[model samples]
Every structure is written in structure tokens, then in C-alpha cells.
Target: MPKLSVVMISMNEEKAVGSVIDSIQEVVPDAEILIVDSSTDKTAEIATEKGAKVIRQYPPCGYGRAMELALKSASGDVIVTMDCDATYPSKDIPKLVLLIDQGYDLVNTTRVLTKPKYMPLGNFIGNRVFALCTRIRHGIKTTDVHSGMRAYKRTLIHALKWNPDGPALPVELLIKSVRHGYKFIEIPIDYYERIGNTTLNKLSSTVWTFKRIFCKEYFD
Candidate 1:
């Protein structure tokens, strides 16, 4: 079986990080769990106790930087990126790996099917607008352009460059993957309310995404 590497970026997620790691272990016992944590709380300590390789992101780097650090440290055939807030279902990991084994280069998890009521109306609208922009500008057809959970071959990282320093990393990944002619697949996954306060500034992130889309930074 190919080795699976699960990379999660966390900050002050002590309440949910341990449970998330446990869930991932239950589903993929042999999988490597890498946590890029910049938490002021015990999040890193908890993840360490749970057997996850913890990389303490010093000076409090942003989410994109954290993800980049985790990706650089990952050593697996396949890479799975998700949040450590327990919102993403670890039970669906096998299904994602199965898709990758079947020759898909990238598999993105969509939260639209479950339609959690806790999702803010502004975020829903922002996501739709971003998806529309992607389809119109890049001709990539995907339902959830901003979904956090995704799996892809580790080698695909070599073919693309990530530029966003904030929450726009997911969109940039999809855009680059499509531009590079990688096979893409989307699977509907269950969504749950997050356990702690969200650090996302939806307005700022949305503006950044739109700026990138219109300026064609994704192509460059």
C-alpha cells in the first residue's frame, strides 16, 4: 500500500486536534500525520502526545506558509490536507485514497452535499462567486472551490507554484492543477460545525481571492 501523509495546520486548536488525529489513525492506521502548529495553547503538545509529527511554526506564520512547511516535510506517495478543527470527516480518507489509486491526480472534498446550516451566508455566496470565476476564467468546473479537504499525489507539487500568503491557497492549488492538465475529481463529504473560534477573515480572504482571479496571478 502506498504511504499516506496527512498534513494539518493548526492554531489554538487544543480542544479538537487530538480527536482529529485519533480519527485519522482509526481510518488510516499506518498513515503519517504531520501537524504544522503555531498555537499559543496546548495544541502542539496534544498532537505530539497523539503521535503526530509536530512542526512548531515559529513567529506565527500564516496558514499558507504553514501548509508550505508541512508539504516540504511530507514524505508519502499521497498527500491529504485538511483542517484540525474536527470539521472534516476522517472516515472518508480511505475513499479519497481509493480515488488516487484509481488514477486521479487530485480529489477535492465538497461540503455542499451535506449543507451544514452553520455555514455563514456570506461564505456560501463568496464560494459560489469564486467557483463561477474559476469556471469562466479557467474553464475548471468544480462545485466547491474553497473546500479545505483535498488529496493529491505528492509529485503534483512539483508542477505548480503557490503564491497566496493567506487563505487563497486552496483556490490557487486547483487553478494550478487544472492549468497543468492534472485529472481532477470531486467527492461530497460530510461537514460539521467547528469546535473553536475560526481564525478566517472571510472578507479579506474573499477580496484576495477575487484579486488573484481577476489579475491572473494563478496563471503566473
Candidate 2:
């Protein structure tokens, strides 16, 4: 079996991090768990107790930087990235791995199968608009451009040169993957309300995403 590494970036997600790790372990027992935590709470301690290799990401960092740190430290053949707030279901991991096994270069899990009431109306609209813009601009058809849950071969990381230092990382990844001609797949996955305060600044994030999209900096 190919080694699987589950990586998460956490920020003060003490309440949900442990449960997230446990759920992933239940689904992929032998999978390696890695956490890049910049939490000021007990998130790091809890993750360590749950058997996840915890790497402390210092302050003054963004989600992309944390993700990059975890990606660099991951040792598995396949790397699965998910949220630490329990909004993403680890049970869907097998589906992603299966796609990777079938030779897909990158697999994204979409929550568009069913709209959850907990999701903000602004987020729903923004995501759809961004997805449409991505398709029109780059010829990449993704239903959920901001979906956090995704799986990909570790080697795919080397084929892309662009890396954003903020929340725009996911969009950058998808854009670069398309530009590089990597096979991409999106599957619907279960989504839930997050357990803690969301750190996302919807306005700023959306603006940054559009800026990057228009500037075509993702090609850099």
C-alpha cells in the first residue's frame, strides 16, 4: 500500500483538532498524521497526544506558509490536506486515494453536493463566482475553488513553481496544476459546520483571490 500522509494547518483549533486526527486515523489506520500548528491554545499538545507529528508554525505566518511547511516535512507517497476544524469529513479520504491510485495527479473534494445552512450566503456566492471565473479565465472547471480538502501525489508539488503565502494557495495550486497539464478531478464530499471561530476574512480573501486571478500571478 502506498503511504498516505494527512496534513493539516491549525490555528487555535484545540477543540476540533484531536477529533479530526482521530477520524483520519480511523479511516486510514497506517497513515502518517502531520500538523502545522500556530495555535496559541492547546491544539499542538492535543495533536501530539493524538499521535500526529506536530510542527509548530510561528506567528506572522499565513495558511499557505503553514501548508508549505507540512508539505515539505511530509514523507508519504500521497499527501492529503484537510482542515483542522472538522468541517471536512475524513471518511472521504479513501475516495481521493483511489483516484490517485488510478493515476490522477490532483483530486479536490467539493462540498457542493449539498448546500449546508451553516455556510454563509456570501461564501456560497463567492465560491461559485470564483469557480466560474477560473473556468472562463484558465479553462479549469472546478465547482469549489476554495474547498480545503484535497489529495495529490507528493511528486506533483515539484511540477509547480508558483506558491502563494496566503489563503490564495489553493487557487494558485489549482491554476498551476492546470497550466502544467496535470490531470485534475473533483468529487463531492460531506461538509459540516466548523467547531471554532473561523479565521477567514471573507472580503480580504475574496479580493486577494480576484487580484491574483486577474494579475495572472499564478503563472509566476
Candidate 3:
């Protein structure tokens, strides 16, 4: 069996971090839990107690930077990235790992399978719009380019030269990996309302995702 590593980036999500950790443990018993947290609250404390390797990303760096830290610090054959807000389905993680074990290079998760009861209508529409733009501009067929939950093989991750320190880094990852000839797929999952206060700047994130969709590297 491959060593599975669950990586996440957190910021003041103390309310949901512990439950998120426990849920992952329940699904992937021996999975390595790694969190790059810049929480001002007890998120790191609770996560550490819950058996996750808590890497303190102090000064609250950008999401892309913290995510890059979590990904590069993981020590597993496969890496799964999710948010600490507990909106993603942890039960679906095993399916992602199974796909990796079945020879897929990357497994991206989608939350638009059903009409999301929890996600705001604007966000739902925004995600689909971004997905459509990506399909047209970059030729990637993923339906949820901004979904935080996804899986990546260690070799495919390290063999690439893309920087994870930009807006919508996942978009860049998908584009770069495709350029490198690696395979990827998107699997749908149930979505839920976040457990804590949302710190997301939807406007900025939206602009950045679109900017990344049309990045010059996509044509490289």
C-alpha cells in the first residue's frame, strides 16, 4: 500500500480543524496528516493533538505559499490537498487514493455533482464560470478548477517546475502537468457549508483564477 499524505492549509479555522483531522483518520487509518496552519486561534493546538504534523505558517502567508509548504513537506507516495474549513468530503479521500494506486497521475475533486445546498449560489455559479473559461482557454476539462480537494502522485509533483506561490495555484498545476504529458481526472464529491468564518476574498480569488486560466505558461 502506498503511504498516503493528507495536506491542508489553515487560518483561524479552529472550529473545524480537529473534526477534519479525525474524519481523514477515519477514512485513511495510517495516512500522514500534515497541516500548514497560520491560525491565530487554537487550530494548530487541536490539530497537533489530533495527530497531524502541524507546520506553523506564522504571519499568515498567502494560501498558495502555505499550500506549497504543506505539499513540499509531505512524505508520502501520494499527496491529497484540502482546506481546513471542513467543507469537503473526507470520506471521498480513499477514492482519490485508489485512483492514484490505479495508475492515475492526478485526481482532482469536484463539488458540483448535485445542487450544492451549502455553497452560496454566487460561488456555485462562479466556480462553473471559471471551469468553463478554463476548458475554453486552457483545454482542461475539469469542472471545478478551484476545488481544494485533489490528489497528486509524488513523482508527478516533483518532476514539474511550476511555482505554487501564485493565485489559483491549482490551475497552474493542472496546466503545467498537462504540458508535461501527465494524466489527470476530476471526480465529483458532496459539498458542505464551511464550519468557521470565511476569510476568502472572493473577488480577488475570482480575478486571480481567471488570470491564471489565461496564463502564458498554458501555451508553453
Return the TM-score for candidate 3, rounded to 2 decimals: 0.95
Task: Give each model a TM-score.
Answer: 0.96, 0.96, 0.95
lDDT of 3 by residue, 28-61 (tens): 9899999999988999999999999999989987
Ranking by TM-score: 2, 1, 3
Query: Please, what are the lDDT tens digits per residue for candidate 1 over residues 1-220?
Result: 7899999999999999989999999999999999999999999999999999999987787878998888778888899998999999999999999999999999998886434676777777777778888889888888788888999898897556887486678888887887789999999888888999899988778877876666766565
Residue 134 lDDT in model 3? 81
Residue 111, candidate 1: Cα error in Å is 0.8
Worst 10 residues of 2 by lDDT: 211-220
Q: Scored by Cα lDDT, where does model 1 land?
A: 0.86
Off by over 4 Å in 3: none
Q: Per-residue alpha-carbon lDDT of model 2 for 75-175, expressed as tens digits?
A: 99899999999999899998999999999989987776556676877787888888888888888878787888999788997556766565777888877
Model 3 lDDT-worst window of ten:
211-220
Q: Kindly report which residue stretches of model 1 are placed more than 4 angstroms away from their true locations once superposed.
A: none
